[model samples]
Target: MTELMLKYFRKKQQEVQTEKIYDTQCPFCSMQCKMQLIEQSIVSRKQYKTVGIDNPTTHGRVCVKGLNAYQHAFHKERLKYPMLKVNGEFVRITWEQALEQIKDQFTRIQDEDGLNALAVYGSASITNEEAYLLGKFARVALKTKYIDYNGRLCMSAAASAASQTFGMDRGLTNSLAEIPYTRCIILAGTNIAECQPTIMPYFEKAKENGAFIIAIDPRETSTTKLADLHLKVKPGTDAALANGLLKVIIEENYMDEQFIQERANGFDEVAEYVRSIKLAEIEEITGVSINQIRKAAITFGKEETGMIFTARGVEQQTDGAAAVRNFLNILVATGKLGKLHCGFGAITGQGNGQGAREHGQKADQLPGYRLIENEAHRTQIANVWGIHPEDLPGKGVSAYEMMEKIDEREITGMFLMCSNPVVSNPNAHFVKNALKKLKFLVAVDLFISETAKLADLILPTSSYLEDAGTMTNVEGRVTLREASCPCPGEVKHDWQIIVEIARVMGKEKYFSFSSAEEIFNELRLASRGGIADYYGITYERLRKEGGILWPCPELDHKGTTRLFETSFAHPDGKAVMVVVPNKSVVPKEEVCSEYPLYLTTGRVMSHYLTGVQTRRSPALAARNIESYMEIHPTTARKYQIVDHSLVKIESRRGSIIVRSKYTEEIRPDTIFVPFHWADSQNVNNLVGEELDPVCRMPGFKLSAVKVKPVNDVNI
Candidate 1:
């Protein structure tokens, strides 16, 4: 980490070279939306711009966010060198000083409180290789049992549902190419219009092909416009609604008895549970008419081939995993799986959400999505890491639990990697307070994010355009992100940064990765024989095919586009249809006299999660300058609030003031807020600290709040 070592370690690109174009992807969402980066170089400077490319997943339709993805790298606030917290203010420092100090502080913390005292909070936005390296660095060099990622907030509930229902976790059960031919499509909880605008064409094509589309949400979004039937299901009643669908499907005799008998387990329990769910009760709980519910069930249940999609809005509930499982129960009962045009998928939100979670970044997982506590899985990963099986740490607590540990002083230090939890985590103020309690915090980011500003030391990392690694898109397509240009200044790829720190700490024996590809080579070996199975996915293959889906276990094996083509991943070659009783489903918060409105949070088309990167784009920044609460016109009238007027919204946890926009786009008793700003404008400031018991995913979507009118404002 010394400047001398860094001088030797870093290679500068020579005098101006011929301009070139490289195939890459946008850094915003899981569409990873394929794009071309045109790089213009002058000496040590690089200016890059993005152009959308045709692909099966997005079909060349990149959003405004994707088109301006490269702007953040050129932002004035981008970190050019490591910065040390000197006398409560960040000051430029050599990499040597920062890393040496971090080593000393971390070692001292571990000596005082044990190895688990230093935890790692990773990101779903980092590449697969970097995610693998992060897991290895923690378990091998740092020897800590605490490591988790941002995906716990985005996809953990859906992931848990997939693994429980299908015996494996892949973002999509089938490819995006097959969507057009489906007989029906059910979109539950996902807002495709804003979050995944690029994939809209696929569903539109399905509509053209005479397919029926059903949308379920608490709000009427752009996606609802495309649905033949829109079920405005009440927030937190996802399980009840799903149970109602199953009940109607059974009563209508639409269940595929032959398929269930041959391909699944626990169906009898599922059937028994649904038998007790009455449509009237479901109507009361979900706030959807019984007739509409019956019609939707009949439409989808009678279809021979169709798909069901779920996202964070529905999966971030207290019974999130169970709610997802309930949807899967409908899928299994319908038998619209294991083939083309018949599938289930959880739309991913982060750039590397699917890939990062598969490669050992989660607290209870190893590479290949293997369980950490399983002896055989532990031994396999231990052998690949060149460490004893006993040396591997046991399952650690989740991301939110780590915060509690920090508050208790059990974890005094943390390495925050590429995520801005201060603004993204539920109960933002509480997370920030816990972060303040940490004895040492090192944040890796390209700019001064909300969390980075609070770090004891901040390290500069290369942007997605400056790094070459593999990413798995929403359809489970693993594509390579070719570096469009080299890292500028003293910035380094995250993998390189970790490797240098490991070498400096004298753990080079296990952390000496020369490049991203080298780390990927080891990743393939580590992933062998496990459920996610990335052993056969090579960089060359990724380029040749544009992308390849996983479970490709042999060099000559073709990748699996449809995960459950024949048999399930469970030991018995059958999926377990988890029976979730509707009576057990209850939200952590409820609408009371004080907090009478149901508050839901989501994304706007112009901004992405945490908004650290997209907010830098002049085009996007101009489109959306700040966050606003979307209140129904009727609801706004009740509080004496007018259109485009500033208002204060308060929850049990906290409160924030924001401009209010009155529209009829949402439910009368509900409020919608976009969580992309900081300070008083941050919507997450009012979010609760409730987490799902199974996946440990925070209930970020649904909360209870009260609104009061403030100063008048208009857009």
Candidate 2:
């Protein structure tokens, strides 16, 4: 078996060598790993090692995916040219013919149902220029209010929560370097080990310095292994834990009175409400011991410098927006804000996820991190576009909401760029039907992925290696570069294709630009003084000086490492302490015995999110070839499940058949599954469409499900 596996791996590697260098950023979970090419003859392949730049923020280190990026880039299954699906068959077609077909179909849709009948979807994996042009084409050309990206699934809740409290929805207050300087770090529902692997070293170093680490999660994760105190609260009970922690801090007089009185509002009401809830009640609601909660509170209240980090796990809950608001309350009560190493930070999932939103790809936002609905922000964008502020649409439906609207026929057409929602979206069944219901669906991708297969038109685009663009990392550092390889076949860059499509549709005025460099330059000029500062930044300077951190306002001004220190940008110049009462979204009311075990999904080291790009790669496939569940041995025994045994994971929403690997790493009532599976064993098939009220993000982390041995002979 080993020999056979090695032979197959070598054969795939040989085939990859013969292919052209497809330089593109890894489309996995947003590290946007950079790649360099030095391919020798196809027969005797030669490649360069992945290298990390001396980033001002990250120093010079990448995670496992970045190191193995070349594998995904040179995968054999990568779509080589444009292909048309006719009568349930994908046939290769010329770029001209495909473009012509798309133009005709799109024109027909507009002529039939007005521009509002068509919708355009962008992706976080796309370049800033591509994302910007996509929104522009949809709004300016198509004149459609339906436009958004998949980042809504990752950070929309957190963004809405932050804006409601702090009046800004930026990524984070400090970079990963701030971890080493923190005296107390509260990791609320963020598992950095499996998600943001590159930032873990700083967390480890902070522990060495005696920094207190607190983890608030339903299940103990790899990040929790290093926690000084782990509050294993019940699922969707984060607000309860946060409220309990706040009550303890206030009752024990651990809060900073002077800071609270000076830089905050609504404290009296917040304190009054928090004081009403005793520690005992908090313990009952959150399922965390009061003593542990008190210890975590004391750690935060007593520390001189404290930081709080949240991820999708915290924001994907039904009460996610409330959980985020309460987290800010803890920071405000402890006086952790306005400091070099203290404040609230969000561990965003995508590499260009932050940049994607900043560049105006979102339905609610415009370029320069400005709100599309805000008069001033609209005026800013209008000035850039030489149009009236009213030209842009108000905030459109978010991703999950959009999917629901698709079934309702509120949205008729969709133009997807560099995103695969068929497998990645929560409640895959609903997404599949929604795509099928669309009057027209145009897909732009590097391969004919699951989502691509659902499209009426597919536009083959250049990979990261064949395009020139800038990608911003999680730390808010922006890197600029050129493509390493030439474009394969007639595949064009995303920006070029978007421009051409708009031009062919008689909207050439909106896409009058020639290159991505010009678009980037104009965007940088527009982003001045915003949280994502680029006033002093230029493509010429970045290409020569490497990437720079945001808030680089002027050439003389040094890039800011810490933000909102002296005072806030809000009207009152004070942060609000929103007293989020201890509330549970999933009481016995939400889930029942029919769907018993709590199931959570995340990424594995061997594969990336959805696995469309990574699974095609031979190296990644060799690492993790099959889909399996990580079930606690205790639960496995109860269900009579053994290691590598075929099992059916059934939920009220749906069910999937996958192999099981019994282990004690997870809790008995909890089962862990990676979202990387995309074929027969795709775990998302069983995930429900429940969402957080404010952000409208689906609850991908928490779902009740049952597991049983696959007894059928077909298995």
Candidate 3:
């Protein structure tokens, strides 16, 4: 039997040479750092090692996580087959059994509870082709109105703001290669040094070339240390700081009147609001003083070429979208957009965040970033699907809103793919409970993720290295991710799995996709004339070029690597300056007598979101084994908490225990913790569910809490 198994393995791998390499990109972050996956054989075992590939995004540099991506793809606990919870134990089940069960459960739920009762939640990590199929699966196969992805938790705020402000949303307005020549950069609530270290070299080059750098964050993160100016704004106060900066820009005559007159609109209203903002109030809201704000504003306003990059730190708040818009105001007011090295972009964190949102997977959007609510956009997609416009469901709720619906028993069944909301969502305890309420859940994942543990049936799926599809990077570069290996066991590509399920549900014709390429071709047609035009982005072209940026509307077009060079995507051919009212930003759960400290959550070096893949990575796991709260030394003294001491941090919503790591880099009034761990260590457990009015993003970045030493708690 052993010899037969060895022969089977040998036959499967085709007796390949150990040194064989497949060029691919890292499967983790939006940077999509190019790397070569090398096949390694030890005795009867085969694994992979990655070497950096010279590319526009990474410039031949890969982060520690990128280097270890292959390890997690073949992690020890990788799901090998479909599993069903029988008698409270996950038992191995054949694919037929799993599909039959899902079909029966889903059909019954839809019949009894209506189509809206079944929800489809997906991930940003999956390829763009996979996202588009899942969206189709939900709409055509199930005809459900509830469909959303994990990106709503992370990127929706920035997407909302950018769309409303610029009339189109691209992760970066200017490609990353242009940053080194930029004269100034504002790192707004993004820790690129830790979260996206590979791309930091561009900023470093710009710094060497005399570019002024400004970092705005509550904690003095690695990103802040490198900045020429650190605006340590109080937690949840990003909007106030941004509004005040715009105020200073307008008041000091730093805004370009000529540019505003020629290329933008609605600045007069924004100017009206900016003038009403008082400097004293701004200082009181953001911790930075008036003098610092003026200096930073002046440096940015006076710069010939500059860019502003924002992240979750500013986008995961109760006012996340409004805050992001306020930040965009500075760039627009200065007439800095659409020019080389002058624009605004949200720093996407997920591997395919840029493409995933352009996608049909989003609740309110169709492929090509077309809005579902619009009759024309709906008709366009409906025609591509060969379905009547009436057959397509209307817009659904946001990600967290879907959780609420599940809790209310409105959404009784869900097809969860690739996302681990139990660890990544706000009020995670609530999410877990709400997920538990689902009568049926079919999860497709490479690993038994935190969310998968609760699934009624879990399907093993191909890992990133074992799948071939295209993903859009943070710079809006849509690049291909080639398969390095075949699925080791019964595992299948995610698109294949979803198609199989669709066939079982009696919708095979609509989803009869033979390959990712075929699906991508349909996506191109679906997105042809929409804002995020992909008509010309063919697989043939992707392989030949480094990467092609979107709005490649024609076969002869080389793609718009530099966005807004000619005009914004709006119908009027001009950007809009959204008038963000100057108001004091308030935390959803305010810091008060009981919870006397501000608690913020973020990523740490060596770890990725939810730690599903990164934690399974032996090296990355060892680098940051146990979660710890970063407490200011002064705050630590007040709480009698010593370094490495376990502390109980309680909020109005939930409580978590983590060892404290004293640091002076954080504000004394605020404590920081990384949200890469699960269970009690999951900081999302303490985060509130207050939705941003514009973006509907939960307040994941800011909360109120109090900490006590575990010993004191025991007493």
Candidate with maximal TM-score: 3
- Candidate 3, residues 1-715, lDDT tens digits: the string is 6999999997866755465687788888899988898886755777677889877678789999989888888788999999999988899989999999999999999899998999999989999999999899999989999999999988998999999888889999988888889898999999999988988898899999999999999999888988999999999888889888898889989898988887788999999987987989989978889999998999998888889999999998888898898888888889888887788879999999999999788999999999999999989999999999999999999998999999999999999999999998888999999999999998998888889999999999998778999999998999998886778778989999999999998889999999999999999999999988999999999989878999899988999877787777788878888777545244366788999999998998799999988999998999999899999998899889999999999898889899999888989999999999999888999988888887788888888899999998762
- Candidate with more favorable, higher TM-score: 2 or 3: 3
Per-model C-alpha RMSD? 6.7, 4.7, 4.6
**Candidate 2 lDDT tens digits, 1-715:** 6999999998877766543443444444554544444454545555545555455545566666766666655666667677787887778898778778878887888788776677777888777777777777777777788888988878777877777777776667766777887999999888888777767888999999989999987666789998988888776778878888898889889888998898888889989999888889988777789889889998798888999988877887777888888998998898888787898888878767878878777777777778778899888877877777787777787776788888888777888888888888888977888889987788888788888988877887877667788877676667775676767677788988888888788878867889888878777766875656677777777766666668788966656666678766678888877778676454322456777788877777767667777777676678788888888888888888888989888887678888898777676777878887775677778777877767777778788898889984344
Screening candidate 2 with a backbone cut-off below 3 angstroms (N, C-alpha, C), the clashing residue pairs are 23-464, 23-465, 24-464, 24-465, 30-350, 30-351
lDDT of 1 by residue, 1-715 (tens): 8998776545443344647887678888898888887777867677676788877577688888888877887788889899999999999999999889888998999999999999999999999999999999999989999999888989999999999888888999988889989998999999989998888888999999999999999988999999999999888888889999999998889988988999989889888878876789899988999999999999999888889999987898888999999999998898888977999999998989999999989999999999999999999999999899999999998888888889899999999899999998888999999999999999999998999988999999999778899988998888888886667789999998999889887899898789888999999999999988889989888878778888899988888878777888888888788778664344568799999999999999999898898888888988989889998988898999988878998899888888889888789989999998988888888888878889988888888999998753222
Q: Estimate the overall C-alpha local distance difference test score of candidate 2.
A: 0.77
User: Residue 174 in model 2: shift from native, Å?
Assistant: 1.7
Q: Best-fitting candidate, measured by lDDT?
A: 3
lDDT of model 2, residue 622: 84
User: Lowest lDDT 10-mer window, candidate 2?
Assistant: 18-27
Candidate 1: lDDT of 186? 90
